[model samples]
Every structure is written in C-alpha cells, then in structure tokens.
Target: MLPARHRMRRSADFATAIRRGRRVARPTLVVHLVLVEGRDDPPLVGFVVSRAVGSAVVRNTVRRRLRHLMRERLAVLPPGSLLVVRALPSASKVSSADLARDLDAALEQATARPRHLQVGRSS
Candidate 1:
C-alpha cells in the first residue's frame, strides 16, 4: 500500500503532471513525470485505471496492483516529483511482473530525458 504522504489526491496535481510533465509510454501503461523545482518533498504518485481497462472490479484490481508496485519504487524518484501512471486496456490482463517491467521501463525513459535536455532545447 502507498503511504498517505506520498499519495497524490488532488486533481490539479494530476492535471499538472499529465499536461506539463515528461511523458513515457509503454505497451501497458504511460508514465508522466514532473520534477517540481526545489520543494524537496516526497514524490507524489497517482494512478489512472479507466473503465476501458475493465469493469469496476478489474479497475480496482489494477489500481491496487499499480499502487502496490509504486510503493516499492517511491524511493527511486526525485524529491518533489509528481508522477501519474495511466493504465491501458491491456493492463487488465498483464501479469504483475510484466506490469512492473512496463512501469520500470517507462520511468527510466521519463527520467533519462527530461524536457530541458531533449534534442533542440537550449541548455
């Protein structure tokens, strides 16, 4: 389970991350990351499992699994970072290990190429 302090509960935060964060997409999930400047607080993580993924029970299951997966990875994130993990319909059928791999790959890409460092952006 994810701790309350590290959980992202605000819709504004979700919107900000989705709209302005660095995005990395994988087969089963998409990760959006925003490195909030200078706050040094714990990283905030949220999940999105839509009805397209499945019915209510499946959606909740996906959410819970994603939440559990994120708990183990919270320490790797930079301080004050905002992250949103959106689930694709394929996520409903994927195994937990595969989900973890998708999450890992997405995070690696998101962190490795932040906005300022991308091609054609002045240092």
Candidate 2:
C-alpha cells in the first residue's frame, strides 16, 4: 500500500495531471505525469481503474497490484510530481509482472525527457 503522503486524493489534482501532464501509454496502462514547480511535498500518485476494466473485484485487484508496483517506483520520480495511472480494459487480463513492466515502460517514456515534463510548459 502507498503511504498517505504519497497518495493523491483530490479531484482537482487529477484534473491537472490528466490535462497538463505528459502522457505515455502502454497496452495495459497509461501514465500522466506533471512536475509541479515550487512544491516542497513528496510526489503524489493516483489511480483510475474504471468499470471498463472489470467489476468491483477485478478492478480492486488491478488497482491493488498497480499500487504495489507504483510504491516501489515512486522514488524514481522527482519531488513535487503528480502522477496518474489509468488502467485500460486489457489490464484486467494481464499478470502482475506484465502490468509492472507496462507501468515501468510507460513511466520511462513519460519521463524520458525532463525538459518535456515541466508543468504548464510545452515540449
């Protein structure tokens, strides 16, 4: 489970990340990342596992797996970052290892160029 400080909880935060952040998509997931300026807090992460993915049980399972995977990779993100991980319908069928790989790849692509990830700035 991700700790409280690292968990993103507000709707406004999600909106900002999804709309202004850099996006990277994989077969299983999509990552949105925004590096906020002047924020002294730790990076915040959020998940979006929708009904399109599965029923409650399956969605919860996928969300949990993603959470566990993100917890390990959180340190790789810069401080004051906002991250949103959205699970695609196919995510319900993949294994945890595959999900992790997809997550890693998406994150890698999203953060590949630091110059492209700054908030309110276009690459």
The collision pairs in model 1 are none
Task: Score candidate 1 by lDDT.
Answer: 0.87
> Global lDDT for candidate 2?
0.87
Candidate 2: tens digits of C-alpha lDDT, residues 2-108 = 99999999898898889888888899999999888766679889999999999999999999999999999988888878899999999999888899999999888
Off by over 4 Å in 1: 115-123
What TM-score number comes out for model 2? 0.91
Tens digit of per-residue lDDT, candidate 1, span 45-118: 99999899999999999999999999998877887788999999999999999999999999888887554212
Q: Backbone collision count in every prediction?
A: 0, 0
